[model samples]
Target chain A: MTPPSGPRKGRPRNADADGAILAATREALAELGWGGLTMGDVAVRAGVAKTTLYRRWPSKNELVVAAVAEQLDELEMADLGSLRADIEAVVAQFASLLSAPETQAALLALFAEATRDPLLRRRVREAIIEPQKRLVLAGRAAAQSRGELPLDTCEETASAAVDIIFDTVAGTVVHRMLVSGEPATPDWISSFATLLLAPLAGIGAGT
Target chain B: MTPPSGPRKGRPRNADADGAILAATREALAELGWGGLTMGDVAVRAGVAKTTLYRRWPSKNELVVAAVAEQLDELEMADLGSLRADIEAVVAQFASLLSAPETQAALLALFAEATRDPLLRRRVREAIIEPQKRLVLAGRAAAQSRGELPLDTCEETASAAVDIIFDTVAGTVVHRMLVSGEPATPDWISSFATLLLAPLAGIGAGT
Candidate 1:
């Protein structure tokens, strides 16, 4: 992707610099966390000048927001002819996202920042959370409109359900990785998708 | 209550000192937040020796935990006329725990500690979390046995519902408070509880 602004410096910007910066952000997040990452380090790792980095973004929070937003894939909400299918498919996508090494690292860093910095918290929520919640709420509404889902489902409830389903998958995957230092398998998504939708049908969908 | 095991300290250990300390903890948490509070400040306000304060709870973590636990009132699953009443009662009690000034403060501190301290995290999950979950499961079982809930409603699902309900409530509540400096209310629980059961009842329990 081209830079939004025209560049003029000692040398033309490296086309691969953005990717390098993103990768470094991911690695730095996993190893050192959000608090430990510095603008100078990011600039050095990306092979960009401190002045050039500052020119592009005013703050580290802005830079991180861009990285997290660009890296975490929005769910593919497929219309699968059933509410269960739609919810499960979206949840399955989230599980895959949680297990992805790059996104997982980025998100862990984001969560750490959220604990300490109010500005970072707002940025993360706006960049990553608000859009994902919109997707879940819209999907729930789509299912309800088709008569496949209970009509009483509200946006907040759907939003809450998304947290329940995805957080557990995220937590379990993190547990597996932290406790055993093992990678999550693709099979976990299917099991998670099935187990997550247990309350969506019959009479158990209140959550 | 007398000192658990100690020679009589200065000033006869003021019979009301413990209450004063706990009250001070609540006030400090509500006003200054977990990160902003200090033991020296609490000692001054409570009119107690720093040594006496340390004698009660060795560290800030231990003090906050004890303070939170003191505010918690265990709920009994009495046989209410309907399953809704029983469930609602338990939720109300649980909400009270989180909504209280001291408990919420302690919980936010614990959640922050969870990111770094593996021991604190484990203790939080086991001592604080597991017992609350067991209550929801046991309460659900009581409903099932009384023909208020379906026999097929898995205890795992019930427990998960409770977990997300409380967690989301906490997450959203904190988000609101942090951004707007408003207090989190209990109003969400009524609709939250109803919608939680709606998915279980399917279309039969119409909106």
Candidate 2:
């Protein structure tokens, strides 16, 4: 696998450098938080020049988003044999992510900044949120095929269901962890699952 | 209503001063955010001396919590005859509050600040988050009485349900408005309500 030729001349951009910088960003976020994180410090931690860091990321917010998005890429969908189990697994995974001190700090700090900056907010949505939401869509489609949900007669209904479900699942887990300051323990997850899936499953073949 | 007598104070500490100071704090939060807000600046905005402002609320975090709490006081639960209607109404109310620019800025700033400060986190919970949570309890009780939900089999189950409901309702609305940057429009509300209540009602009559 030969590397594709760059439009430019000298030394091809170091792909490993990107990984190192992002890893350093996450570490800095853990120690200093968003308010205290500095581009110079991140560059030092990454063993790269400040100019190189700036040339790549342009801003601290963009760099943090990229770093956080890399972690979120690991939140994959699992085919755990049932819709309820899959949703519960995702909920647990999300709860763990939000509970991690580094992710929690970075996420809230980014949210605060996003209140004033639309472009940054969109970056967060595209980089961090949109990928996880795809899991909800996939889970729903799996459920529908298994007859756990009614087949939507229209695209609008399907889209609406996805949005609502995404909000409810993600929102509930986040609120519980961040706002309410409660652990998403196994017992709590079971109770939430019952409330969430009971009716939808009732509409299935068994009922 | 008779005011409670203080231990010893000049002019019984004019009650209007508290109002003016909290209002000023909110204004400063909107203009300067948590990072830029200062007690002295707030004092100037309130037309009160810095010492007087300090005497009332010892720290900026405490002052901001009080001001934000006052705004949350406006989020009263409406008894709209049905659980679904009540939930939808509260969701709309919360969406409107969160969507307001001033509230959006202040809430997120406070959240970010609270992340590292345990005292500030508790203050936020007691002042802002907990008060609105009562609506969840009230809504649940109302639904139980109307036969829209079952009588809790035990205290633990009842408590768990309340926590889940509160998080789902508040979290989804917050995420939609703040994280997702989407409007919680009427159509969205209806879709959310149907999904939320359908399950609870199913449990009620043992469907």
lDDT of 2 by residue, B52-91 (tens): 8777776777778888888879987888988888988988
lDDT of 2 at B21: 86
Report how far residue B81 has shifted in candidate 2, in Å: 2.5
DockQ-derived CAPRI band for the predicted complex in model 2: acceptable
* lDDT tens readout by residue for model 2, A63-128: 888888887787877878788788789888988888886677677777777776778777888878
| Candidate with the greatest DockQ versus the true structure | 2
Give, for candidate 1 chain A, the lowest lDDT window spanning 10 residues.
A175-184
Given candidate 2, what's the lDDT at residue A87? 77
Which stretches of model 2 miss by more than 4 angstroms?
A1-7, A10-17, A40-52, A204-207, B1-21, B24-56, B203-207
* Candidate 1: residue pairs that collide: A203-B200, A203-B201, A204-B200, A205-B199, A205-B200, A206-B196
Model 2 backbone overlap count: 0
Task: Summarize candidate 1's per-residue lDDT along A11-72 as a digit string, tens digits.
Answer: 67666876777666665654444445677888888888777666666776667777778776
